[model samples]
Target chain A: MSRHATAEQLSSYVDGELVGPRLRLVETHLVECQDCRRRLDGLQRVVAGLHRLEPLAPPPVLGQDLARRVRLEPKPRDLLERLEEHLRSTPLQSTVGFTFALVFALAVILYLFSGWVERQVLLHQPVLVAPSEVGAGAAVRRVGPRSFHAEDGRWLEVGVDPRGAAVVAVDDGVVRQLLVFEPELEPLLDEGVPVVLAMEDPAGGPGRVLEILPTPPEP
Target chain B: MEAAESTAAALAQSDLDLVERHRYGDPAAFEEVYRRYGEMVYSLCHRLSGDPDLAADLTQEAFLRIFRHVGKFRGGSSLKTWVYRVALNHCRSRLARRRLFWRSLAEPDEPGPEAVDPGRSPEDRAIAHDEGRRLTRALAAVPVAYREAVVLFDLQGLSYEEIARVLGVRLGTVRSRLARGRERLRQILEEGEPLAPESSP
Candidate 1:
C-alpha cells in the first residue's frame, strides 16, 4: 500500500473522476511526495505511450461489405408487407383488373368485328326469318340481337342477331358456348375474330367492356 | 439545469436534432455526426481492440450501426457516451465471438496496433511507434477488467461516471478497476526502469 494515496485513487485523480476536495487532496499529496510523483509520472508515461497507438484500418472487405449492406438492405419492411404480399397471389390480384380489362376489350372488338363481318357476309344474303319461327309469347327485352356473355361473369353484351350471329373470328370457347345457345350460328361462332364486347352487369350499373376475342364465321 | 447551460445536457439535444434530421430523411446530418465522432470512435475502438484492422472495422461498424439504428437512439446518455457504448459493446462482441478471451489475466499482444501514418518519415515516427507498442503490450498484459477501465479513463479520457454508465457498473467498481489497471500498467512500464510506488503513509 502507498502512503500518500491508493493506486486507484491516484488513477481517478489523474482522470479527473475524483471529486473536489478528494481530487485536491490527491493533487496536494502528490506534490509533496517524490514517490507518488514518480508513480504519477509513470502512469502518465504509460498513457502517453498508449496515445501512440496507431489506428488500424479494418479489413478492406469489411468496409465494402458494410457499405454494400447499407445500400442494399436500406429499407426495413413496414407492418403491412405480409398482407400486401398475400393480396398479390389472390384471385383479387391487381392483374385481375388488367385481365378484366383485356376481356372487356376483346369483347368490344368482337362486337365491332361481328358487325363488320355481318355487313361483309350478310351483304350477299338476305335477313331470312326462319320458316319455323320461335315466336316470343309476350314480354321481351328489346336489346340488340348480336349479344354475348362472359364465362367469368354473368355480364351480357346485348343487341345482335342470334340466328346468324357472327362472333369474334376465336373459334374456341366462344363457338362452343354459342353452339349450346344457338346451333344455327354455331358455324359463324367457330371462326374466331379477336373483338371486344359491352359488359352488362345485370345486378348493377351501365354496361362496361368485357374482353377481346375472334369468333367463327356463320355458314 | 434551469440556470446552468451545460454542454453535456445540450449534447443529447444535438444528437436528437442530428438524429432527427438523419432519421427523418436527411443524410447530411448523419454525416455531420459521423464527422464529429469519427476520430474519437476510432481511438476508442483502436484502444479496446489491439488490432488496427479490427479497430477500423469496429470504428466503421460503430458509425454504420449508429447510421442503421440512429433512429432508435433514445435521448438517454449524451451522444458521446451513447456512441462510446455502442463502439465498446460492438468490440466486446467481436472479441467474444473470436473467443480471443482474456486468459485469466490478459495476454501480452504479440503484435500491436497498425500504423497508418505512412506519410511520416521513419525517424519522426519511430519513437511514437515504439511507445505505442510498449503500451499495447502492457495493456494486453493487463487483466481485461482493468484494461478497459484504464483505456476508458486514461487514454480516451471518459469520466468515471461515464465509464460506469458505459460499462454498466457501479462508480466504485469503475474506480477500483481503473486503479488496479493503472497499478498493473505502472508496474509493467517501470519494470527496472527507475520507477516504483511510494511507501504509504
Candidate 2:
C-alpha cells in the first residue's frame, strides 16, 4: 500500500476494518509516519472528549413543551376536504391531473409490491428494521398515497389527496400509530429512553417502524 | 426538584391525551402545543441560530408550519423528529435568506448568562465553561453543512445512522462528513487556524 493512504482507508483503519495485508501495511505506515499517527491519536482524544461534553438538560419544562406542540399541530382534514371538493367539481383535470394520477399509480404499485416483499423478508430475515426508512424518501416505501392513510386520516382519495376515503383504524384507535405524535415522547426520550415510533400493524397492513428516538427516562 | 419531577410525571398523561384530542380537531389543542414546545423550540433555535431573538421568531414560524402540516405527519417518525425536522428546515431556510455573515456568527457572542454562584468564583468556572463555548464557536466557524454535521453528530450525540437520516445522506457519506467535520472543528478550536476550504456539496 502507498504511504499516502486515502482518508477513507485511514477511516477504515480507525474503525479497525483494515485487515491482514492491509492491516500490516497500515500498521507499518503508522509506525513510520508521524503525521498519520498523530491524526489518529488526535481523533481518538477528540472523540473521547466529545463523549464528556456535559449532556445538556433540556430546560426542565421541555417535555410539557413538546407535548404542547404535538397537541397544537393542525390537522389537514380540511385540505383533503377541499381537494375532494375540487376533484368532484372539476370531474376531470388536464395534464397536471393526469400526470399526478400517473405518478400516483406507479407509487401505489411500487408501494404494494415492496410492502409485500418487505413483509415476507421480515418474516424470514432477523434484521431489526428501524424507522429511519419511513422518512427516507429514496428508500423503497411500502405504501402508496392511495392505500396509505396520510396525516389527514383519510384512507383513500383521488389525485394524491387524502379525502373521500374511509378511515382505517390505526392501532386500536391510534391513527398513524407509527408516528410518535405524543408530546411527552420527545423530552422523555431525550432524557435517554430509546423511543420506538411504531405503527400498529393496522391489521391487514405492515408493521412499520416510523422513527426511533432515544431519550433516557428520568430515573 | 422533587416537585418538578412529580409535576413532569403527572403532566405526561394529560399531555399525551391532549395531543391526541388536538389531532382529532380540538381547537384548544393548539394552545397546549404552543405552551409545551414553545420554550424548547425557542432554546434549540437560540443555540443553533446563536440568536435568542431570532430563535423566538423562528420558533413561532416553526410552530405555525408544524400546525399546518401536522395532519400530513404519518406515524412513521417521532413527533420529536417531525417537529425537529420542521425547526431544522426553518433554520435552514432562514440561513439561506440571511446574510452569509450572520449565518456564521455562531450563537450571539454576548457573554452567556452570569453564573449564579456566590462563594465559589463564577469567573473561574465560567472560564472553564468558556472552553466548551470555544468548541461551539469553532463549530460555528465552519460552513453550515459542516456545522450541522458536527452539531448533530458530536454535540447532539446522534448515532451515525440517525445523523444520516437527519442529514438525508448515505451511511458512508455520514462517516466521511463527520470525519471531515470533526477534523475541521479540531483544527479551528485547537490550532487557532481557519478551516481549510472544503469542496463538499
Candidate 3:
C-alpha cells in the first residue's frame, strides 16, 4: 500500500479492468499518494484526449474499388483449398473432415477415370450391325463388333483391311461374296452409321459402289 | 444501451449468415460486410499507418483477405473482432515490411486531413484541431504494440475483452499494454517530445 501504483494498475483502474487485491491496493495508494494521484490524473486525461480524436472517414473510392475487386475475384478452385475451407467451417472434427474430403476427392477421381476408360474402349472397338438373317434388302442393325446378320440366316462381316480398304463380306449356305468400297468411303464407315450398298457385281469385286445410302431403305 | 445490445445481438446472428452467403457466392455478401465495417477498418488503418493513401490501400487489401478467407470464419468470434484482427494483422505486416512501423509522425506543423470540422466556430475549432493534431503525433510516437491497444480501446471504443480478442492476446496483456501505451502517450504529450524513443526490441 505504501508503494506507488504502477502505470498498468492506474491504466486498468481507469478502465475498470483491474480487480481483486490489486485494484483495492491501487485505490488505497492513490488516496495517500499525491504524485500517484497526479500521474493517474495525467493518464486519464491522455485517454480522454485520444477519445476526442474522432474516427476518420476513409476515402470514398476505397469501398467502390474493393467491392469491384471482391466481385471480380474468382471463387476458390483448388479442390484442396475448398476442402480446407470446408474443414474450417464444418462442425465435424478436423480428422473426420479431412477423411471425408480425401474420400470425396478419391471417389471423384475414380469416377472420372472409369468414364475415360469406357470412352477409350468404345472409341477403339469396331461398331457392329445386328440384323436378323433374312435377305440383302433387310434392314441391317449392328449386332456385334465388325459383323452384321441378315434375316435370311446370312452373315455379313464388315471391316477395314490392313491395306486401308473398306470390305464387306456376305455369306449364305454355300456362296460368299466380298464387296470392297473405295478408300474414300473408309472414313465415313468409321462414323458408325448404317450404310446401304449397291454392288456392281452380285458375286463380289473391289472398288464397287453403284449406290450408297446412309440410312436403311424404308420398308 | 438497450438499442446497442439489440444491435449487437442482430449483428451476431447475421455474422455467420453473411459468411455462409459469401461462401455460396452471394455477390452482395461482400458488399454488405464492406458497408458495415469499411469506415471502421479505414479508421484503424489510418490511425495506425498515419497515411491516408496507405490506409486506403491497406483497407482494400484487408477486406480482400477477409473475403477470400471468409469461409474459414466459423463463428468462433464476432465478425467485427475477426475483421479487426485481420485488418490489424495486415496493417502490421505491411508496415513492418516497409519499415514504416515506428516511423515518426508527420511534421508537427502540418495540418492533418482531419484538422477541420465545419460544424465548429473558427477560434474554438482551431484550438481543438491543434490539440487533436498534437495528440495524434504523440500517439504516432508510441511503439506499434502499445499504440494499437490505445487506439482500439480509447479511439475505437472497443471493450477490453474485444480488444483482447482482436489482438489475440490475453486480458492481462491488454491491461499492461493500455497502461503502458497511455503512460508513453502522456509523457510524449507533456514533455513535447517529437518522438518517443523506440525501446530496443
Ranking by lDDT: 3, 1, 2
In the range B109-194, model 2's lDDT, one tens digit per residue, is 54233224444465645543555455556656776676676667665656677677666789888777777776776566557632
Worst 10 residues of 3 chain A by lDDT: A123-132
What's the residue-level lDDT of A90 in candidate 3?
A: 79
Q: What is the lDDT of residue B188 in candidate 2?
A: 61
lDDT of each: 0.62, 0.56, 0.72
Q: Candidate 2, residues A168-195: lDDT per residue as tens digits?
A: 3343334442332245455666676665
True contacts kept of each: 0.44, 0.11, 0.60
Candidate 2 local Cα displacement, residue A97, angstroms: 19
Each prediction's TM-score versus the true structure:
0.57, 0.49, 0.65
Superposed model 2: Cα runs more than 4 Å off: A4-29, A48-219, B1-20, B26-44, B100-108, B111-128, B193-201
Model 3: residues >4 Å from true position, as ranges? A18-24, A76-81, A84-219, B1-9, B106-122, B193-201
lDDT tens digits, residue span B81-178, model 3? 99999999999999999987544565543332563466677775665566678887788889889999999988888988999999989988998898
Q: Give the winner by DockQ.
A: 3
Candidate with the larger DockQ of 1 and 3: 3
Report the C-alpha lDDT of model 1 over A1-219, residue by residue, as the tens digit.
237778877776666667988888888888789988877877766655555556543344544565565665464334365357666766654677888986999999999999899666423221112111213221223223332333222222344433443232222212123222234433444565333444332223354443434443459
Candidates in order, interface RMSD in Å: 4.8, 7.5, 5.6
Tell me the tens digit of each residue's lDDT in model 3 across A11-94: 878778778988888888988999998787777778766766656887768888987897788873455778786778878655
Q: Between 1 and 2, whose TM-score is larger? A: 1
Error of 2 at B106 (Å): 10
